[model samples]
Target chain A: MIRRRKIAEALFKLLSLSALALAIGTLVLLFGALMVDGLGRLDWQFLTSFPSRRASQAGILPAMVGSTLVMLVTACVGIPIGVAAGIYLEEYARRTWLTELIEVTVTNLAGVPSIIFGLLALGLFVYTLGLGPSILTAGLTLALLILPVVIVTTREAIRAIPVHIREAAFALGATKWQTVSDHVLPYSAAGILTGVILALSRAIGETAPIVTIGALTFIAFLPPAPVTSQPPYVSFEWLMSPFTVVPIQMFAWVSRPGEDFAANAAAAGLLLVGMTLVMNGLAIYVRYRMRKRVSW
Target chain B: MEIRETVSISHSSVMESASHRRARRRREFLIEGALLLAALVSVAATITILFVLVFESVGFFETVPLLDFLTDTLWTPLFDDPHYGILPLLAGTIVTSVVGLVVAIPVGTVSAVYLSEFASARLREIIKPVLEMLGAVPTVVYGYFALLVVTPALQWIWPELPGFNMLGPGVVIGIMILPLVISLSEDAMRAVPMMLREGSYAMGATRLQTAWRVVVPAATSGIVAAYVLGISRAVGETMVVAIAAGQNPNLTWNPMEPAATITAYIVQVALGDLPHGSIGYQSIFAAGLVLAVMTFAFNIVGHLMRKRFREVY
Candidate 1:
């Protein structure tokens, strides 16, 4: 019986080691496949060109530009409301029933499926509001998707500020606005920025929500540039322009029935993986810097 | 000279004090109100999602009897003779989710055990972030990986395997949610007080024996919570299943067969152009409603388990 017990323990340890190995091995193999199939395809022309009938001629410029524009709008809309909500929950709201309700609601929202958010946006923004399938519509939908993330992260950052700092500000006769804006927010800016950037990266990787919003799958033309001449030198028309993003483009390629399309899909996935890694790496580095600077 | 300057400063402050205080107070009220409104947007979003789903789904049910929608075996909303039965899709979802859980639970829990109990701090730090990075890799990329890698590998071993089988997507999703399970379960294991392990050691328990018996039992609630959350994610996952699991809604118990999950159906319909307010378009909303309720139920169960069993220390 003692010998059997010892053998069982050894087997369990081996199983545990293999489990970790399986995860890392799978990731390494996935990266290897992507690099082997995709790296040669990525070039200046591939980045600059638009979708083509022939897979070899296709470029991802429009999708890249569209994704950037969407991210810009999403950041602009999501960050302020999300940060304010975080500030309200952490610093301003007293322990009340209403505050608890908001807290619960945000937590639940974080768990709601991204596709449901898409369905809501389809009904509300596309049909009811007549935003059509424009970048603005997709941007607004993504904003809702990432709001809970931003709020949660921002709240954590703000909560980390020492209580003594707030007390010190109060003792000096500074009003709540002055105290938060002048001191608390500035001190927590690095942390909050890190959170915001990470949230945006997640937003970029999301495909289903945008897909459900009826974003044009094939686009040969770019959204009118943010700077175009008509009356004003700057143009807001691009917000209303129909667009396709990188993940959507990748999905389109993957769905097609041919080897070339498969290669194209692999290439697009490689670009997306690169973007996600870079963004996440930046977030980590910023967080590391902040952690190093503040002993508290 | 300092006293004179202080008095002058005080006099100037007093001269502006009443109006300045009033302005500051007004500004505070406005900003507070605005912030409160901003916080309420999440609540508003929840209400909007629920309201839109129910309202649109009601329209769908009016066209197709609610009983038929629930009980029928087929889901062909786009065909000439449309059958709105959601059972096939639900079955597909359940099978794939079960397959995913089968892969994720054991692997994730074992890894968590290894990391929490045996690994040194330095190794733990390096591995944890890599696990997180694994999780954060986009689902679309996972879809590509599932289609190009797992499916082919399976076919090479078993020539009878279908091109777009549930098994492939299910396994990929399991890998995708592994980070979530490891992180959450590891937290639970770590939460099991060190004293428990020491007590087991005092009784001549080996390291494996202490972890398997004492710590595992102590951390059961957290492990259960993590599994529940992982299951919820598997059920809601869209892209991987959509791309790899074939679009045909086949009602079968076999994971090797092609099947359409509820999410896959939603993506299928949305990818095409259906006229707004049509029954076909509303059907996706109906499917969305079902998906929402399914995930929400899982989340509530997980929340309850955590609340009941969470270790305070």
Candidate 2:
């Protein structure tokens, strides 16, 4: 009986260890495969040139530019609203029923699948507002997608501001906004930025929601300048333009039946992965700096 | 992941009435009012999402039979006598999701257990973050891997199966949600006190026995929550199924067959130029509503499990 038990235990341990190794094996192997498949194709033109009709001919430039523009717009729209709401929740709102409700709602929203946001964005921005399927509409969808993340993170940053500082400011007859703007916001800026960047990184690789709003899977056109150089730039008519983001473009390439398109998609995916890692790394570094400074 | 930040603004708001006596109470109210306004904005965002999905879904039912949508097996939306059955999509969702959970749960839960419990503190620290880094890798990237890599590999084993069968998407999604399951389950396991483990050890139980018999039951609720969350993620997953599990929406339970998930079908319909007010377009919203409600159910059950479980000291 004892021998049987010992043998069983040994087998179980081996199985579990192998399972552990398998999980790690998957990640390392995927990266290795991506590298082997994608390295020779990685070039300056891939980063700078336009996409094309054929796999050998296509480049990621237009898609990259569109992704960047959409991300910038999303960040611009999401940060202020999210941070303000976070500040309001953490700094000012009493722990009332409404506040609790908002807290729960925020958590639920975070779990709300990304694709649904695309649905809402289509209804609200694309159809109802007649903004059409454009960068601005995608931006709004991305903003809504990241709003809960920003609020949660900004709230944490705001809450990290010591109560004593608020006491000192109020004691000096500072108004509530003055206290928050002058004292808390600066202190929480680094943490809040980390949250925003992390949230944005998550948004950057997303292919589903934008695709739902018909984020053009293929577009040769570069993103128009942030402020269009043309007349009537601010009008609703301008918001109804075609847009192609990298993830969506990559998705298009990836789902193709051809091996060439698959290889191109892998190369594009490397770029997307690089983008995500950079965003996450930057977030970690910022938080580290903030932590070090605050510790001192 | 929801952290409670302890932000105490100086009790000075409460005490201001004593020192400065010119409608100080009103100023307090004003500050509170501003915060209330912001809170309302958040509340409104939540309401807006619910309203949009519900209203559009209502529009959907008016065009299609509610019963057939729920019960029928075929999912072709464009046939002149189109069958708007949701079963195929839901079945595809279940097959992939269950497969994903099967792959992830044991591996993830065990790894989490090892990280938070058995591994050395140094090893625990390293492994935990590395595992979480998996979570940070996006689903779209996972899709690329699943299609380009897993599908081809799978086809080798089951030559009869198409390249885009359910197995690849299911396996990929399992990998994608592994971090959540592991981390959350580990949190649950870690909360099990050292005394219980020691007692089992003292009674001559092996490490495996202690973990399975003592720690697991104690951590059961959290493990359940983790699984629920994983299912939610799998059900809501769009990119994996869209990329790896081919777009044909057939009603089949066979894992070897390539079928479309609810989200994949929505992506397919929305990917095309399906005119708004067309039956095809409304189907996307209808599918979205089902996906929304399904995930919502998973989340509520998960939250409730967390709430219901009380640790016995």
Candidate 3:
């Protein structure tokens, strides 16, 4: 019995360790495959030129621009609203049944599938609102998709601020708004920024919602210039212009039946994966620094 | 004279007129109201999602009987003679999710157990972040990896596996959700009090024995919650299945076959220019409504499980 037990213990340990190894091994394999297929194809021209019918000349420029513009809209629309919501919930809202219901709703919203958000945008933004399949619609869809994430993260960051800190501000004759804006917001900025970056990174890779909102798969032209030599020197036409994002572009390439298109997809995937990893790394760094600095 | 001068300066700086006080109070009230409105966005979003899904689905069910939608094995919404049975899509979802859970649960649980009970602190620190990076990697990339890398590799082994079989994407999804399962399960295992482990040790239990017999039992609720959430994630996952699994809706339960999940079907319909409010277009909403309800149920269960675990310890 003792000998069998010893064997079982050793076997279980091996099993567990191998599980971890398997996970890490897969990650390494994924990166390795991406590098092998994509490294040669990824270059400056590939980043700058427009996509072509021929895979050799295809580029991600339009897609990249679209992604940036969409992200701009998402950040502008999502951040202030998300942060304010977080502040209200964390700092101001009284603990009532209504608040509890809201809290539960927010939590559940975070788990709703990204595709459903796409459906919502299609029905609401595209048809009912008559926004068309524009950059603005895609951005709004992604904003709603990331809202729950931002709210949850913001609330967490604010909650990390000790109650005593708020008490100190109150004792100093600070109003509730004053205490929050002056003390809580400043102190939790790093955490909130980290969450926001993480949320945006996640949003950057979303293809389904963008696709569901009917982003054109083959867009060779850029949105109207946001800056021009006109008297006003700025334009809003780009907001209503049809756009395609990186992941959607990647998907279009992947679906094509050719080795060259596959290479293009791999290269695009490399760029996207690299972008998200960097953002995630930055968020981690921010979080680490915040943990080191903020003890109270 | 100096004291009087100081007091006058302090009074002028600190005191405000009644009008000014009222203005400040009103400003605070307005700010609070704005913040409250901002917070309500989430609630509003949830309501909007439900309304859009149900409202559109209502339009769809008006044409297709609810009984046929539930019981029919076919899901050919785009066909000339359309059949809007959701079973095939649901079956594909279930098969892939089952495949994913089959791969994920044991591996994830074991990894979590090892991390919580066996690994050194430094090793744990390195592994944890690496696992988080796995989760952070986008689903679209996973889709690429599944379609290009995994399918070819699986084909080499099986010799007859289709290029877009569910198995490849299912495995990729398993890998995708691995980190979530490990992290959540590890948290639960770690939350199991040290005293229990000490007691097991004192009773002559090996580390593995203690982890398996005592810690695992104690953390069962949390592990269950992790599995529940993983299932929800797998069920809702889009890109991998959409890319690796074929768009044709196959009702078969074979993991080796290509099938379109509900998510994949939605993506398919969206890829085409189906006229707005057309029956085909409305069908995606009905599918989405089904998907949403399934995930929502799983999420609520997961939440309750986590709550129960928290209450226990």
Clashing pairs in 3: none
lDDT of 2 by residue, A227-264 (tens): 65677655443345678888887888887778788778
TM of each candidate vs. truth: 0.97, 0.90, 0.97
The digit string of per-residue lDDT tens for model 3 on B20-55 reads 778889989999999999988888899999999999
Give lDDT tens digits, candidate 1, residues B1-313. Answer: 9999999999999888989888889999999999999999999999999999999999998899989988999989999999999999998999989988999999999999989998889988889778978977888999999998999999999999999999999999999989999998898999888998999999988878888899888889889999998998999999999999999999898999999999989898888999999999999999999999999898888777776666455
Candidate 3 versus the native: TM-score?
0.97
Query: Considering only chain B, what TM-score does candidate 1 achieve?
Result: 0.95
Relative to the real complex, the DockQ score for model 3 comes to 0.82
The better-scoring model by lDDT among 2 and 3 is: 3
How do these models rank on lDDT, best leading? 3, 1, 2
Docking quality class, candidate 2: medium
Residue pairs with clashing backbones, model 2? none
Residue-level lDDT for A52 in candidate 1: 96
Assess each model's interface with DockQ, reporting 2 decimals per model: 0.77, 0.52, 0.82
lDDT of 2 by residue, B241-306 (tens): 998898988788888899999999989988889887777887888888899999889988887776
Off by more than 4 A, model 2: A1-13, A168-175, A227-240, B1-35, B201-204, B309-313
> Model 1: per-residue lDDT, tens digit, A1-296?
77887998889878987998889998898899888878888888889999999999999999999999999889989999999999999989999999989998897888888888889999999999999988999899999888998999899999899989989999999899889999889889889988888888889989988999988878999888777666677989999999999999999999898888888888898999899889899999999999999865
lDDT at A185 for candidate 3?
A: 99
